[model samples]
Target: MRPDPHFLRGGQGGFGLVAAMFVIIVVAGAVAAMARMSETQNATSRMAIQQARAYQAARAGIEWGIHRALAGESCSDTFTLEGFAVAVQCDTGAAVSLPEEGRSPRFVSLRASAQYASPGSPDHVYRQLSAVVEKDD
Candidate 1:
């Protein structure tokens, strides 16, 4: 009995199938990894945007507090804008004596904080700002 030479020349019958399956798996894994990386990058970009918005809201609150303090009005309030919430507070310090001035001058400290959260996100972004203003009188 003799084996057929043609069968040997044709190569192993199952080798091609195994090689094809391996290539498919490798390609699928690479694709999945790329998708995960893209998702992570998108999330990072979104967080950066959220942080910027929170900072802007905090700055606005600070400006509001300053305006109210200068106008002799209430300087504390909480407000919401564009999905962000801002809270502002002001503290008036005791007057300080000045050598050149007849009357003492007072100082006001303003603090502002802003917070924001995106839908379906568990984390929240926050920003705070503070400033000290002196009365001209």
Candidate 2:
């Protein structure tokens, strides 16, 4: 039996086409995965920045409260730091209650509540911090 000229020349032309398609598919998938990972990393960095801003805002609120308590001034307003805002309460009402053993007579409790926008959203993110400021006597 004599072989056909086309088959004798090469029967693997379609195989090469199929292999090329497979390689293209794999490369496309890898590119997509890398894009997703890059987006995730950028989002994480943004969140870290927002968290740092909120913490600084909270610290500012604490300082403001301490100053108000020491000077006998009112400390019941929202204070802004950078782009973050905080609510301060520096009175005897929500004072930091100490355990019976380690109570100090010259201590004042400072409470601060901070609210800022989420890194990728318009919704707010809230944080609370409390400290006991000892008198400078």
Candidate 3:
């Protein structure tokens, strides 16, 4: 007695179901990985922005220090701007008199620093700027 060909084909239907389930699992995993990558990119972009802002704040503080030194005022202060806190400090060295020169000039060194922190993140960003300012005696 020969077996029916239809019965042999019926057993193959389970193989199709297993193959479909494997495909679905692979697609779901790929989607999850993409979501995680997107989230990481967004976080990195936010940190870059915060770092740039902190650098700008530090540069502003350095400019303020230079201005004060040029104006013959005290060049130390602390201030806050746009969620960043800045501190500026300037130090002036002894003036050097040039030989055969009608007028002598002095140079001053200035250092400024700024710090910023995001509300929900534990990371803190810091930037520092330095400059040499010349003043005429």
lDDT of each: 0.89, 0.76, 0.89
- Stronger candidate by lDDT (2 vs 3): 3
Residue by residue across 1-137, what tens digits does model 3's lDDT show? 99998887885767988999999999999999999999999988988888999999999999999989999999999999898989999888888888788667889999998998744565588899999988987
- Best-first order by TM-score: 1, 3, 2
Say which candidate scores most in TM-score.
Answer: 1
Model 2: how far is 135 from its true place, Å? 4.7
lDDT of 1 at 56: 93
What TM-score would each prediction reach against the true structure? 0.87, 0.76, 0.85
Please, what are the lDDT tens digits per residue for candidate 1 over residues 1-137? Answer: 89998887786778989999999999999999999999999989988988999999999999999999988889999999788888999999998988786878789999999998654665589899999999755
The local distance difference test score of model 1 is: 0.89
